[model samples]
Target chain A: MASDQKVLELNDLNVHYFTPRGAVIAVNHVNLYVKKGEIVGLVGESGCGKTTVAMSTLQMVSAPGRIVGGEIKIEGQNIVNLPEKELRKLRWSKLALIPQGAMNSLNPVTKIKEQMADGITAHEKISGAALRDKVLKLLNDVGLPERVYNMFPHELSGGMKQRVCIAMAVALNPAVIIADEPTSALDVIVQRVVAQTLLDVKNRLGVSMIMIGHDMGLLAQMVDRVAVMYAGNLVEVGPVGSIFEHPYHPYTQLLIDAIPSTKQKKPLKVTEGLTHDLRNPPPGCCFQFRCPFVRDACRQKPPEFKQMEPDHFVACVQYN
Target chain B: MGGLTRGYFIQRLLMFFLTIWIGVSLTFAIPRLSGSDPTTAMLLTMMNARGYVENADKIIAAYKESFGLNDPIGIQYIRYLWNVIHFDYGFSFAKFPAAAWSLVTPALPWTLGLLTVASVLSFIFGVTVGSLMGWRKTPRWLNNILPVSLTFTSIPYFMFGILLISIVAFKLHWLPATGGYSRDVNPGWNAPFIKDVLAHAIMPLISIVITSMGGWALGMRGLMIGVNNEDYFLLAQAKGLSPARVFFRYGIRNAILPALTAFALGIGSLIGGSILVEYIFAYPGTGYTLYRAIQEQDYTVIQTITNLIIIITATGVLILDLLYPLIDPRITYKKSVAS
Candidate 1:
């Protein structure tokens, strides 16, 4: 039972950003999960609120933005309204982060060993030789040389720094690691290496992960399941292979078609219409504005998730 | 190595001397360009004093020969350079027969002692207040209250000094009105003398710290705010580092880099001392001495003091340049090897 239990769950999660004029619903009533040892890729366009979901899961949506409603459960423990101290305890030890922009994720002035060690000491009571040995072992686990322990962030290349982040995330063997677009800033070659490192770490540690990105191709190679978001809504989620083969959502199809290939040239799919304003989403299926099969019935009420097949789900009027 | 590569070290060392050389050479040229020889300046003052003189040209020629003013400009410059290095300034112009070094030596201790304490105190208070104001985690009440405390910054420092002198010294009779120390206490390493000096220092110290620290606070706040938005800062928080660790190691450590450059400029002015504050309190520091020298047209004291200030400022910047690579690893790019 424990083996198959979900490690992380976002139940009807909602994030809103407070603005002077009105509150912008950044992440609307989203539901997703990462089962034990699973790596689920959260793919979406830029500013579609995938990042807001990640931050909400971490209970770290900065001011001007707040988690209005949701239950974020890690190992079945709800952390949405958890106190600051309890939240700190839950972090790293239960929920780690491989943050985006690995190029700047590391503190520039601090040495690598200390940066790696400080996080460990924050939760545990290891010091001196033991701490040094732990940090060195982490570096080795991430395939970094022993010499890297003495270097600063600037001394290490971008890929190596991302690996350091990967190593840091697993320091406490957290239940879930939300890697927010971890490969966005890297080049193609290093992106593959870093993606492989994440998978390797997942395989070795049996830790669950939520890899957020816009690169459909990269996610296909790495993630077990794909969770696609559009304008803060979870449009589709299913096993990665089936979703790529039979993407039910029109936006998901467009996203998949836009993926580059060496075999043939393809026109980039331009969606039909713009995303409706988040502050006041219209009373209808969210995809009605852009869906090719928009009908009068689609505008009657907002569509809820309709089970399309085993382990696959879609939110659209046609599916309903 | 802390990024202080050997080549960079050598380069910095050369730059240090180059700055001093350029500054000293400018000091040399400016006086000559004004076309007022010391002997001529002296003669003109004498003429103003007595209203007549005989064989002024012959006297000027004799004085020039004795002072080596008749020598080639290049030779005189080299000789002057040699003299400055050794502190062999002959005598004060206003107080003849008294060495130039002697005129400045007594004031040096008072100025250095007061300004060092005040400047250091100001820097610490400013950094703490600034880092707090910059930090998002700081308590709302404290943040709201901090700006109110900076009200003194709106009032000029010397004006604040005058206010303190009027209220604390003149009106309430709480401390002495002026001077480095009480006239009653003998100048020595005694408790009474030290106490008197410290007591007299409080007003000036408060005025300087209160009025000037706002700038450091404002500058640091901006830097901290900028650093607050850095991905590293947010990641540090996500790493579950305690507020203290994240605030200090990640926040201040990076934000303090640009502030260090500003601090070096503070050190420059520290050595020169605050002329207005010193004059206001009659603190008998270098600033007050320089002010008196200006008033008296004492060229020897003024030139010596100005040259000292320039050297000190150059040294401060040089020290900062050398220390930068240690504090900021990104500054280590020397371009000698592959970047």
Candidate 2:
């Protein structure tokens, strides 16, 4: 249902970083779609290309990391071929990013209201009372007191700052919001509050979001669909409940097993060995060495993603 | 609140007085400790006749009375401190009857004008160049230029000054070699006077700029590099900020904080350099007057000039320290106390 209403369609997206060592494949032929008014969670362990995928969506990847291949279409328009100026026009208006470590994201010297005003003024022509009112409304919408507008970022607590970041992200009411580990730095309580605030904003504003995180449980609460990534490739993707209940890919299974559960009396299932290094990734199944169910065929050739159920895709020799 | 602030103000004032006292005591004792008697020097210079029967005690007594050197150390210190507080530095021994303060006052503006203009120009140029080089990583041209620029910055300003004087003034004769202005023109606020002063300042200004711009560029470049790596800058880019805005608004603001502190400290030391540069150019500035006072061992003039420098430097540092809290809220008195 969510896949059918696609708002952002990434086709064969590949991102490579030019390091002194060589060209490292950070995101390899990854394809996914984010639908309108639905949250899509991109889950992966550290250095698994999830963040790279999100960064490439907005063309925010810095030097050395270039989106070498693929097409990114937003609202059916191919953004990959668009000029930087046109791409910039799409950002914050068509697609906004809530970057990692939202706590320190704000300008320390400027007041919160001024920071919001900067965001507003960047894309719009409103000023004076209208701008002030818009900033005040934004502050209020993020569950922050109106008085917070006058305070500097240093004056606010970490949680308040994160809310300010969210406010800034959603200020222009962009169609798609990419939040990369927005609540990772906060405590559990603050994390919940921030997550809920994100959800609340999405629900009220009807903005599609791409939530990136390593934690399945956190993403489980916010996202409608989950795309699991491993070794710079998307191994599995499905509806949130389907992926969580019956994960097919060995990597997805291990990721779910690794999650701590209070109800389960048995010891937590931990995946052995580290993730494959992208610099010299194995030719075959990237996770074969770490997979418990690896077969001879798994070492011979990488398995392509096959749909076992409608909109539920998994790439594994065992599943095939 | 007022009382607390006033108390803090008073504490700073007390510290200022203590610093001056220590400086004066060191100056006075150093001459005595060196086993050099001013009285003996004066007597030797005064005596013209060969093998004249000189009563040393009488000569010392007369010298002590004439110069108020007969007073007890404590009494003299108190009198000196009083004179310093009142800004009444006595006459110069080198030019008797001419007040030291009067000589210093006229020279202060010339030195300050040259130093201020040169320092500001160099700093601005350096920061601009450094920031641009640091932000744009792709251009191989910047990578090639940065090291050469840093090498230029590492050379001492005095060496640069001498080099400029040799090349531009003496060898090339493109500029006047020495003296603030031509002998014919009297120093005034008119166009001709200003032009002459500026013409004379050209070599020194270039020397100062070449010597100082490198450090500013190096400092700004390193800072900009660090700031560019920060998450907030990345966030600014992610928000679709223009490269220029990100470079200036986010990158420059944070990067330039360290440069700002350095600049503040530099403003204070500008006075110190003014003396040296002025002396080298034979510019009629406070530095030249101070040099004359030192040669004549004019105690009052020396004390007054030294005190003015200390006061100016101290005040400049205080202002810079105060500005830290405003620029970066993380800086505070509590942090200083804790450290």
Q: For all the predictions, what are the DockQ values?
A: 0.64, 0.36
Error of 2 at A203 (Å): 0.8
Model 1, TM vs. native:
0.96
Q: Report, for every candidate in turn, its global Cα lDDT versus the true structure.
A: 0.88, 0.80
lDDT score for residue B257 of model 1:
91
| Model 1, span B1-339: residue lDDT tens | 366888887888898788888888888898789986788877887789899878899989987897788999999899989998987766777787888778888988888889889888888898889999999999999999988878898899999999998999999999887789988999999999999999999999999999988988999999999999998898888888899999999999999998888888667676566999899999888899889888877877887888888888888888898899988887864774321
Error of 1 at B32 (Å): 1.1
Model 2 per-residue lDDT tens digits across residues B1-339: 001244445555676567666765675566657777676665555564354536977978886787677788788777777777777767765455788788778878877888889989999989987887778533688677666765656667767777788988888988897777898887778898888888998977877787788888878888888877776777777677677777777888788888988787677566656566667777776778777778877665776677777777666666766566666655544412311
With candidate 2 superimposed using the best TM-score fit, by how many Å does residue A173's alpha carbon deviate from the native? 1.0
TM-score of each prediction = 0.96, 0.90
| Model 2, residue B260: C-alpha shift (Å) | 1.4
**Candidate 1 chain B worst ten-residue window by lDDT:** B330-339
CAPRI-style grade of the A/B interface in model 1: medium
Alpha-carbon runs more than 4 Å astray in model 2: A1-3, A263-271, B1-53, B65-73, B91-99, B137-151, B274-276, B287-302, B321-339
Q: Give one clash count per candidate, in the order shown.
A: 0, 0
List RMSD in Å for every model shown.
Answer: 2.0, 3.8
